[model samples]
Target: MHFKVSNNGTAAVLEPYISMGGHAALLKNDRSVFVHLHPIGTISMASQEKFQENYTQGVLDREDICFFGFADDSTGNYFNSNTSPNGEVNFPAIKLTTPGNYSIWVQVKSAGEVITQKFDFNVIL
Candidate 1:
């Protein structure tokens, strides 16, 4: 699902993984940035309240569920964050000490019981 905050600094953009990643410059010159992570693409999540009753009576694999982050600069000096209490979804944050560009990413894995997938809304300041 996509997120809209009326007139907030955060903006969403669909960046598809290209054959070569293409020529992109994830940079900005601002401060007090915000990143709203929404569910992008996922491995698929159905109903799984009952583990044994579900698939082969075993837990799912969710260790691959990891998020990736990158700064706008080559120096790599950006902060990172994760989801909230339940951990279903999240909005990772990065406080910019220097007004420059930064890149953020997230990967929610499909576990045996619970899992989630979110997007990255960049507010580069």
Candidate 2:
């Protein structure tokens, strides 16, 4: 699989040759700064399904389902603004907070097998 990345100061935009299954990025110096990105968005599909299930079953109050501390937005649509239809994954710009080394791990599924590729980059302030 091949990937092309474009760093826009605060975030990195990735265009993969093929559709991606899952992907993540981490600050090499500070592990606390990590983000998992998907083709859909920040919220995982499993989480969305679970939230839907709970909402459908009336197990949780509609007003109580908060996403990333935002209430009344259980669908996670607010955080999914970077979704693309061209097999591109756009990570949040906040992930590149400080100038240092970073690693982005991209995963793709092919023929029922999962393959992971790690790409390294440096952020200079």
Candidate 3:
């Protein structure tokens, strides 16, 4: 839901789910994510279902986490990931592999219906 940037470091929120349905997307109008970046240094990303006590604004309710890459080798699908059943993507950390165009998405639904949020970005590795 937020990206923290500083001389200290760059931190992003990422979910482990293979789809774009989660709490981060549920809280705001912006559904998708796109980034054009070549990491200047080490980066850390996470999907936080429950924010730590020090976090003033906290997470709502959830308990699943996932992180995925490139829906397919094709460009049309738009690489993305999100949270699962409990609105929580269950992973806490990820190690950098490679870099290129990247996409991030979050989704949420209610009353048997569904909604989707997505975004795309580039990693200039």
Q: Write the per-residue lDDT of candidate 2 for residues 12-95, one digit (tens) a residue.
A: 332222333245555465675677665444777798789779879988654543322223333433235312222333333444
User: Which candidate gets the maximum TM-score versus the true structure?
Assistant: 2
Give the per-residue lDDT of model 1 (tens digit) for 24-117: 2223335344343323222223433343254355455322333222212111111122221122232233355554454443333222222222
Task: Work out the TM-score per prediction.
Answer: 0.21, 0.46, 0.26
- Candidate 3 structure quality by residue, lDDT tens digits, 1-125: 33321223432233322233232321112424323221111123342223333244543322221132222212222132232222322212233345555455444343344434566655455
When 2 and 3 are scored with lDDT, the better candidate is 2
Models sorted by lDDT, best on top: 2, 3, 1
- Best prediction by lDDT: 2
Model 3 ranges with Cα > 4 A deviation = 1-93
What is the lDDT for 35 in model 1?
41
Query: Model 3 Cα RMSD, Å?
Result: 17.5
